[model samples]
Target: MENSPEIATDAASLRPAGVSAVALSRLASATGGQLLHVPQNADPDEIAISGVSIDSRSVRSGDLYAALPGARFHGADFTRSAREAGAAAVLTDPAGAQILGSDPGLPVVVTPDPRSQVGAIARAVYDSQPEDGSGLSLFAVTGTNGKTTTTYFTNSILRALGETTGLIGTIEILAGGQRIPSRLTTPEAPTVHALLSVMRESGMTAASMEVSSHAIAFHRVDGIRYDVAGFTNLTQDHLDLHGTMEAYFGVKAQLFTPERTQRAVIAVADDDDEWGIRMARHARAQLGAENVDVFAMRGGVVADREEDPDRRGADWTLRSMSRRGIGHRFELVHRDGRSLRVSTGLPGEFNVANAALAALMILASGVELETLQRVLDDDDPLTTDVPGRMQLIGTEPTAVVDFAHNPDALARALAAVDPPDGDGRVILVFGATGDRDRTKRPLMGEIAAREADVVIISDDDPHGEDPAAIREEVAAGARSLVEAGTARAVEVYEISPRAVAIRSAVQMAGPQDSVIVAGRGHETVQEIAGVDHPLDDRAELRAALDEMQEGRWERR
Candidate 1:
């Protein structure tokens, strides 16, 4: 967290150390942009910002604020605040350029397509060279679920193999033995290069990154070359942004492009996995520079034969797996018939899939299977905990907090749980996020109703969307299950106060019941209509569970 005071107030003040105006102009020229304010020969030493910002509040004094037109509002509206806050210059598309006025004679850079140029401009400013030259092996794991877990476990396995590792995921940044809060699952273009640069400078030999579909589509990871790429599984999620499941899957598939990665590893668990595998293979065959490696958790079935579903077994078979105090121990069976008993403190079957994906990446990176076996046995799995991912909150009533906001994720989470010891029911308290993939709201409801004995639908950052509307969607879906007789009558409740929801669920939960709180897993803040409200689901769930214990004692 060590930082210089000069750049403390304005991130713009931290212009990449050695950039020059000539270089900036060259970069501008490449993007067909015009430098409106500063002289072409202006000393680059004084240039502070590497890119532009749309939000003025986030703009540092040295930032190049961008006055772009957004669907909701014009970035130009924030130009005055940006300048007052110490913006060195402003960047805007020509349309915005005509509307925005600046005080303090702030410099303005005009381009026709400011948004398109942002990534390229940031790359030039940061001087992002290919990652291979850094002598560090960079791996990117992408999918609908398990991205964070795979990245986290990949870090662990890499560490076990004697390599210093860095990670960027939903939980936090695992860097320099410190946990830094993450602003985004995948940060913007400049920030990504900046973080990687820091990792390289720190002498890390390997780094594992969770690449979100949005990040790939937006060119956030534009400048980096991944040594290896891993896929977990794809499912229904993020439809709000991508518009359709196919489009969503297409974005995730962007990671396996041969030009972006050297080696590809795929997990064939879902129907859409074939698209990823086909794309990777096509990339290798067409590009000829990258190599493709396919992996299946299902055993003995040839890669092509597993397509039949009935014949396909897992590339790695797990058995005799017993849950022990928030962790699970199982034996991983490889295709060669050699099995390794792995005692991973990580919970859930999804985690085992994540571990298998991580292990595959390690093997793909040239780590021997024998070394991976020893690491799985001796190296503790609990050490690399992925936050909010089937994260166990308490043993009593067995409360778990997860980031499963969609039907697929919810199904996996429900399946992962050991279904209360005897007659205990799995009680789920969750709701769909507002303004996102509304279609999945009821699907999630049906999932909860069909899989869980009790369902509690609550708030999940309605963000400009009516909370009631969201709740109704979920209710409707759950109602579908009841009407269809797919499940027994579901117990549904609308609890606006999440803390109260957790408390109510805990109060009713018995020793045999499993309480699951999903959606907004590791998110510390609840975002609504672009405003963030402080609300950590994990903390709230734990606090409620602790109070429930006290209440039981008091009743005794």
Candidate 2:
């Protein structure tokens, strides 16, 4: 017999593929969440899952319906719908527990706080409990603008270097060949761990994920221990959830806490980066964390003589960088006195920074600089394209779809595709999100008016926010430029329907011109008045451009 140490695995210890009813009870009990329903002597190894679903419409027969409570609607209200669709069981909060009485025949579990505990419960019930600390390396990137792109870049580079990888971001989750559509910026804790386990089983050695401030604040990433935590940058976003900018930053800062993380990769060019470094330093002193790495894109960069001067910064300095046609070339110099010149087919300086951040993160993972560089230069950066982050739609008169909803990101996008050195205008189409950071509306308008030649204020998921009011505020800010004589008279068109605005903008764009369909990037659905309408900016932009081209063809 082979002398192998017996790995203690139980019903609860079994992986998600082997989960049972007893597993669910223990998961709820561990989190101080109460379980209302229990089958006597239920087996804990009978897996009762295909996956978990929060929406009734998507709930399948084996799924656990997470009946969460929201301000606008109670998830319990959808319980009947979930059951009708064949959900195995319904999970709800203490308040929603009463809804279970309405349907006694349903297999219902009452949780103390469904939203907070669901992730933990999900992790406990599905995953083979992580043995203290062990298994695949996990890297999480968080920021307002670069989260999705940076994660995608890292995933691509890792895969290029021959490591099977898993990625979760704004675009999709790449687990093996499965491309799961992402429903949250950072999946709730249970789904996160479950996905990680699946990745590990699918032969992934590493996983790159995007973490959002909302996820942190809501304790969405509660149970998993991240090997490397990256801070891309921070700016005004999701203010409705955090209430203030300081609060938003506070939530983002929690990811770096000693209790939660081990290593960190922070971007120094952002003001939030300076604060993050400070927070990391404090956490290090308090918790004795060993690996804290920093990379600066510009401005705050500290170059050393030992490092190549042609580089942007000494510590993983970006150097010899140039844009050739539709691609970029740059050098990454590590602290150990090694440099590798890399080229990416992706355009824009922002992408260069994103690539640099990925390099630093890969370096932090103990991969050889040259090997990772070869992967980035040869395989990853060339083919990888983040869904909504600076995703260009057409040529001649170019149209791009970007998720630049805030002022800072909008400013960066404006700086990125600077009008192609021509007499044509940079037209913008965007609208502020409803019930979110109302303060940023005028700022977004101001940036658009200041940066672009023509501004088209349009709808961007005004979700109960008066579309006209949102557009009016943005237009008001844009019109301020003309009123102050700071700009060469800008046109502010109030196009309520987003598609109409996109069509209008694309038609107006000439050969030397560029049209930015801003705000909604990779999002496939647009939420309006509590309903998600199917929408894809990239597809719409493409169709609109094709229409414009067809019209031009007819005119000719």
Candidate 3:
């Protein structure tokens, strides 16, 4: 986009996909909202809301436009555009009502909490009631990280089992068989219900979705019950929004409750991360011991991958792991005598953890273990290339691309990228996203310094924040270790342009070293100021790696 009013922002892409034409009175009854400026010719109950849209530009005929209040502008400010776009009704709060000032003919639904009510109203409009084994078995996966990978794994497994599976997550939304890249980690309430409605209409048998902290905090998944809600460990992330780790975890914890989910799958691989343990206990209490299962990896990740064979209380165990080319194969033994032999092409230890959680969640959904194992045994298993999650683009210096933005994710990515020789270095090129969770910047710096041999701090998405300042804050955190002589052996670089950071990291790396380009995984655009600049980390990393290879050949 060109940073203009005419340019549809990436957010517009998150607008609900299907049309929702429910009676106006149904929406009012669903939200306990009162209709304002009711069209007299049309019965308040008879006026249909054909669709729901938060963005005025995308409003279609018979659509109900939600004028939600935000920190900057009340959604009502665009009421004129919504009306011009043929909106049937407007949903807004009292403040928005005041802004309208008796717009005589335009139908409106006045409610105090439009944001929270959006999902409920949307569910009513789209007729997307996910009853027991309705159109698809819904799976909700949430955590600070690994959400995307787990969703991918679960969806791939479902498809391999001959089920038409839909997937909604950070990477994209898959309905029927169509793939739509997502604008949010989780779409807004109306969009989510609308998408589910689409899948239900398409006769999808199962769908796996990534539920983010923002989704839970904002009730984005309201009115929809999940068959399985998977938690992939909690970590220090999004502190800027939640203010504390406790608050953040509280939001994630809601997804595991009986009211929100029917079953739960928690990864207990890293016993050190106690959050999973707590979530497991909570799920057992809420969903029953039979409804909950824990997975600990003893097999897939290489030597760096740790497994507690004597791990207590785990229902499923990856008993052993061995490498086959770039992939790892493991045997997953259930609490019962049943077992599943699994394999994946991805090399990261975190992928192993994600796959384990995905596998257990699939099992919880009632898929036969033998059938799932047959799917993993195919020449291609779980589709293993998850966009930009630890994707290997080169061999000489072992270039890898990952989406590790937060401190916890960054630390895990560093620890998982072990080179062949023990002395080989892990070179990381990553930066914290600007205008989001500033609290994580220093924490990320400290963690990177502790885990990585070389750190190149650069731009992720400046998004109106000063790019240089963001780098300085992260660099300052890492520099603290150097000043104390704790991380003097760790080399650090402060690069302005991210392209330079990626190339510099690759150039400085030798054959024994691994170069990891973190952040902005699978994203083709980088937001700076108000415009999105075309950029892909995977593409940049590949170009850099190729350039280095050509240079080496010329030198010979």
Considering every candidate listed, which one attains the maximal lDDT? 3
Per-model TM values vs. the true structure? 0.83, 0.81, 0.90
Which tens-of-lDDT digit does each residue in 1-556 have in candidate 2?
0112223211111134444433444444465655555455554234355456666776666667888888798898888888788877777886777766754445566756777766666665456236654457788888777888888888777777777777777666665446666667776665666667766666668888888887887777877667778777777778778887777777777877665667777666633355544544544453343466656555444544232222223255566778767668877665666887766666677777777777778777788766776676566454477788888788777778899889988988877766656566788888889988888999888888888888888999989977788889888888888789786426777886898888788877787887888888989888888889998889888988787777753311
Residue ranges of candidate 2 with Cα displaced over 4 Å: 1-16, 20-29, 32-69, 72-115, 132-134, 270-289, 300-315, 334-336, 380-383, 420-423, 530-534, 550-556
Cα RMSD (Å) per model?
Answer: 4.8, 7.1, 5.2
The runs of at least 3 residues in candidate 3 whose Cα sits more than 4 Å from the true structure, single-residue gaps closed, are: 1-20, 130-133, 297-312, 552-556
lDDT score, candidate 2: 0.71
- In candidate 1, which residue ranges exceed 4 Å CA deviation? 1-22, 32-69, 74-92, 100-112, 128-132, 175-178, 270-290, 299-343, 418-422, 528-532, 552-556
TM-score of 2: 0.81
Model 3 root-mean-square deviation = 5.2
lDDT of 3 at 178: 54
